[model samples]
Target: MALLLKEFSPAELDRIIEMAWEDRTPFEAIRHQFGLTEESVKATMKAQLKFSSYKRWRQRVEHCRTKHLKKRDDSITRFRCSRQRAISGNRISKR
Candidate 1:
Protein backbone atom coordinates (compact mmCIF):
# COMPACT_ATOMS: atom_id res chain seq x y z
CA MET A 1 0.00 0.00 0.00
CA ALA A 2 1.09 3.55 -0.68
CA LEU A 3 2.05 5.63 2.33
CA LEU A 4 -0.40 8.38 3.26
CA LEU A 5 0.86 11.85 2.33
CA LYS A 6 -1.62 13.98 4.27
CA GLU A 7 0.70 14.81 7.16
CA PHE A 8 3.70 15.78 5.08
CA SER A 9 4.67 19.39 4.45
CA PRO A 10 6.80 20.79 1.64
CA ALA A 11 9.68 21.01 4.07
CA GLU A 12 9.32 17.37 5.00
CA LEU A 13 9.19 16.46 1.34
CA ASP A 14 12.36 18.42 0.74
CA ARG A 15 14.01 16.65 3.65
CA ILE A 16 13.07 13.32 2.18
CA ILE A 17 14.54 14.33 -1.13
CA GLU A 18 17.72 15.48 0.53
CA MET A 19 18.05 12.27 2.52
CA ALA A 20 17.40 10.25 -0.59
CA TRP A 21 20.05 12.17 -2.49
CA GLU A 22 22.65 11.96 0.26
CA ASP A 23 25.22 9.25 -0.37
CA ARG A 24 25.35 8.42 3.32
CA THR A 25 21.63 7.90 3.67
CA PRO A 26 20.15 4.42 3.54
CA PHE A 27 16.98 2.97 2.06
CA GLU A 28 16.31 1.46 5.47
CA ALA A 29 16.11 4.91 7.02
CA ILE A 30 13.02 5.88 5.01
CA ARG A 31 11.67 2.37 5.24
CA HIS A 32 11.89 2.37 9.02
CA GLN A 33 10.48 5.83 9.60
CA PHE A 34 7.91 6.30 6.84
CA GLY A 35 7.08 2.76 5.69
CA LEU A 36 8.45 3.63 2.29
CA THR A 37 10.21 1.15 0.08
CA GLU A 38 13.01 1.88 -2.34
CA GLU A 39 10.52 1.90 -5.19
CA SER A 40 8.27 4.30 -3.31
CA VAL A 41 11.17 6.63 -2.65
CA LYS A 42 12.12 6.64 -6.31
CA ALA A 43 8.55 7.40 -7.32
CA THR A 44 8.36 10.22 -4.85
CA MET A 45 11.61 11.67 -6.13
CA LYS A 46 10.44 11.56 -9.71
CA ALA A 47 7.08 13.11 -8.90
CA GLN A 48 8.37 15.83 -6.61
CA LEU A 49 11.69 16.78 -8.17
CA LYS A 50 12.72 18.26 -11.46
CA PHE A 51 13.71 15.65 -14.03
CA SER A 52 17.22 17.06 -14.32
CA SER A 53 17.77 17.03 -10.57
CA TYR A 54 16.52 13.50 -10.25
CA LYS A 55 18.81 12.42 -13.06
CA ARG A 56 21.81 14.04 -11.41
CA TRP A 57 21.02 12.47 -8.02
CA ARG A 58 20.69 9.06 -9.56
CA GLN A 59 23.93 9.50 -11.44
CA ARG A 60 25.71 10.56 -8.29
CA VAL A 61 24.57 7.46 -6.43
CA GLU A 62 25.47 5.22 -9.34
CA HIS A 63 28.97 6.65 -9.13
CA CYS A 64 29.15 7.04 -5.35
CA ARG A 65 32.44 6.88 -3.44
CA THR A 66 32.32 3.52 -1.68
CA LYS A 67 32.91 0.18 -3.34
CA HIS A 68 31.33 -3.16 -2.48
CA LEU A 69 33.85 -5.77 -1.41
CA LYS A 70 31.92 -8.80 -2.56
CA LYS A 71 30.19 -7.19 -5.50
CA ARG A 72 33.31 -5.29 -6.56
CA ASP A 73 31.10 -2.61 -8.03
CA ASP A 74 30.23 0.66 -6.35
CA SER A 75 27.33 1.31 -8.69
CA ILE A 76 25.43 -1.85 -7.70
CA THR A 77 26.26 -1.79 -4.01
CA ARG A 78 23.37 -1.42 -1.61
CA PHE A 79 23.82 0.71 1.47
CA ARG A 80 22.76 -1.34 4.48
CA CYS A 81 23.56 -2.10 8.09
CA SER A 82 27.03 -3.33 8.97
CA ARG A 83 25.86 -5.57 11.78
CA GLN A 84 24.22 -7.88 9.28
CA ARG A 85 27.59 -8.68 7.80
CA ALA A 86 30.47 -10.25 9.71
CA ILE A 87 33.09 -8.16 7.96
CA SER A 88 33.63 -4.54 8.88
CA GLY A 89 32.67 -2.05 6.15
CA ASN A 90 30.74 1.14 5.66
CA ARG A 91 27.34 0.41 7.07
CA ILE A 92 24.49 2.04 5.23
CA SER A 93 22.24 2.32 8.30
CA LYS A 94 23.04 3.59 11.78
CA ARG A 95 21.43 3.52 15.19
Candidate 2:
Protein backbone atom coordinates (compact mmCIF):
# COMPACT_ATOMS: atom_id res chain seq x y z
CA MET A 1 0.00 0.00 0.00
CA ALA A 2 2.91 2.34 0.66
CA LEU A 3 4.02 1.76 -2.89
CA LEU A 4 0.58 2.73 -4.13
CA LEU A 5 0.56 5.96 -2.12
CA LYS A 6 4.17 6.95 -2.82
CA GLU A 7 3.13 8.79 -5.97
CA PHE A 8 0.65 11.09 -4.19
CA SER A 9 1.57 14.03 -2.02
CA PRO A 10 -0.14 14.41 1.38
CA ALA A 11 -2.38 17.18 0.01
CA GLU A 12 -3.38 15.11 -3.00
CA LEU A 13 -4.14 12.12 -0.78
CA ASP A 14 -6.30 14.32 1.42
CA ARG A 15 -8.12 15.61 -1.64
CA ILE A 16 -8.71 12.05 -2.81
CA ILE A 17 -10.11 11.15 0.62
CA GLU A 18 -12.35 14.20 0.52
CA MET A 19 -13.57 13.25 -2.93
CA ALA A 20 -14.16 9.66 -1.84
CA TRP A 21 -16.34 10.73 1.08
CA GLU A 22 -18.58 12.90 -1.07
CA ASP A 23 -21.87 11.21 -1.91
CA ARG A 24 -22.07 12.37 -5.49
CA THR A 25 -18.44 12.06 -6.55
CA PRO A 26 -18.16 8.87 -8.54
CA PHE A 27 -15.19 6.51 -8.52
CA GLU A 28 -14.72 7.32 -12.19
CA ALA A 29 -14.15 10.95 -11.29
CA ILE A 30 -11.49 9.94 -8.80
CA ARG A 31 -9.93 7.66 -11.37
CA HIS A 32 -9.89 10.43 -13.96
CA GLN A 33 -8.39 12.93 -11.54
CA PHE A 34 -5.93 10.67 -9.67
CA GLY A 35 -5.46 7.65 -11.93
CA LEU A 36 -6.55 5.36 -9.12
CA THR A 37 -9.07 2.68 -9.89
CA GLU A 38 -12.08 1.93 -7.66
CA GLU A 39 -10.24 -0.94 -6.01
CA SER A 40 -7.18 1.24 -5.52
CA VAL A 41 -9.29 3.94 -3.92
CA LYS A 42 -10.84 1.38 -1.63
CA ALA A 43 -7.44 0.06 -0.71
CA THR A 44 -6.14 3.55 -0.05
CA MET A 45 -9.13 4.34 2.11
CA LYS A 46 -8.67 1.14 4.04
CA ALA A 47 -4.99 1.80 4.58
CA GLN A 48 -5.26 5.43 5.58
CA LEU A 49 -8.46 5.53 7.64
CA LYS A 50 -9.44 3.77 10.85
CA PHE A 51 -11.02 0.37 10.42
CA SER A 52 -14.41 1.59 11.63
CA SER A 53 -14.33 4.60 9.37
CA TYR A 54 -13.29 2.46 6.44
CA LYS A 55 -16.09 0.01 7.14
CA ARG A 56 -18.61 2.81 7.36
CA TRP A 57 -17.41 4.28 4.11
CA ARG A 58 -17.59 0.89 2.44
CA GLN A 59 -21.13 0.41 3.71
CA ARG A 60 -22.12 3.86 2.49
CA VAL A 61 -20.69 3.29 -0.98
CA GLU A 62 -21.62 -0.36 -1.43
CA HIS A 63 -24.93 0.24 -3.12
CA CYS A 64 -24.90 3.97 -3.72
CA ARG A 65 -25.94 4.80 -7.25
CA THR A 66 -24.13 8.12 -7.27
CA LYS A 67 -20.76 6.49 -6.54
CA HIS A 68 -20.74 4.57 -9.81
CA LEU A 69 -21.00 6.26 -13.21
CA LYS A 70 -23.12 3.58 -14.85
CA LYS A 71 -25.54 3.54 -11.93
CA ARG A 72 -26.04 7.30 -12.01
CA ASP A 73 -28.79 8.96 -14.04
CA ASP A 74 -27.75 10.29 -17.44
CA SER A 75 -29.46 13.62 -16.77
CA ILE A 76 -27.37 14.25 -13.71
CA THR A 77 -24.06 15.22 -15.22
CA ARG A 78 -22.40 17.51 -12.72
CA PHE A 79 -21.21 16.31 -9.32
CA ARG A 80 -20.83 19.65 -7.59
CA CYS A 81 -23.89 21.62 -6.56
CA SER A 82 -24.80 24.51 -8.87
CA ARG A 83 -24.91 26.90 -5.93
CA GLN A 84 -21.52 25.80 -4.63
CA ARG A 85 -18.71 28.29 -4.96
CA ALA A 86 -15.30 27.20 -6.12
CA ILE A 87 -12.48 26.56 -3.68
CA SER A 88 -9.70 29.14 -3.63
CA GLY A 89 -6.63 28.92 -1.43
CA ASN A 90 -8.19 25.83 0.15
CA ARG A 91 -11.19 27.81 1.28
CA ILE A 92 -14.63 27.33 -0.26
CA SER A 93 -16.42 30.63 -0.74
CA LYS A 94 -20.03 31.17 0.24
CA ARG A 95 -21.63 32.77 -2.79
**lDDT, model 1:** 0.62
- Candidate 1, residues 1-95, lDDT tens digits: the string is 23445556666676667668766556666676566777877888887779998898778756764321332355645554444433222223443
lDDT of 2 at 45: 98
Q: Which 10-residue window in model 1 sums to the lowest lDDT?
A: 86-95
Which pairs clash (backbone N, Cα, C closer than 3 Å) in model 1? none
Q: Please give the range of 10 consecutive residues that has the lowest summed lDDT in model 2.
A: 83-92
Deviation in angstroms for 11 in model 1? Answer: 2.6
lDDT (CA) for every model shown?
Answer: 0.62, 0.88
Clashing pairs in 2: none
Q: Please give each candidate's TM-score.
A: 0.58, 0.85
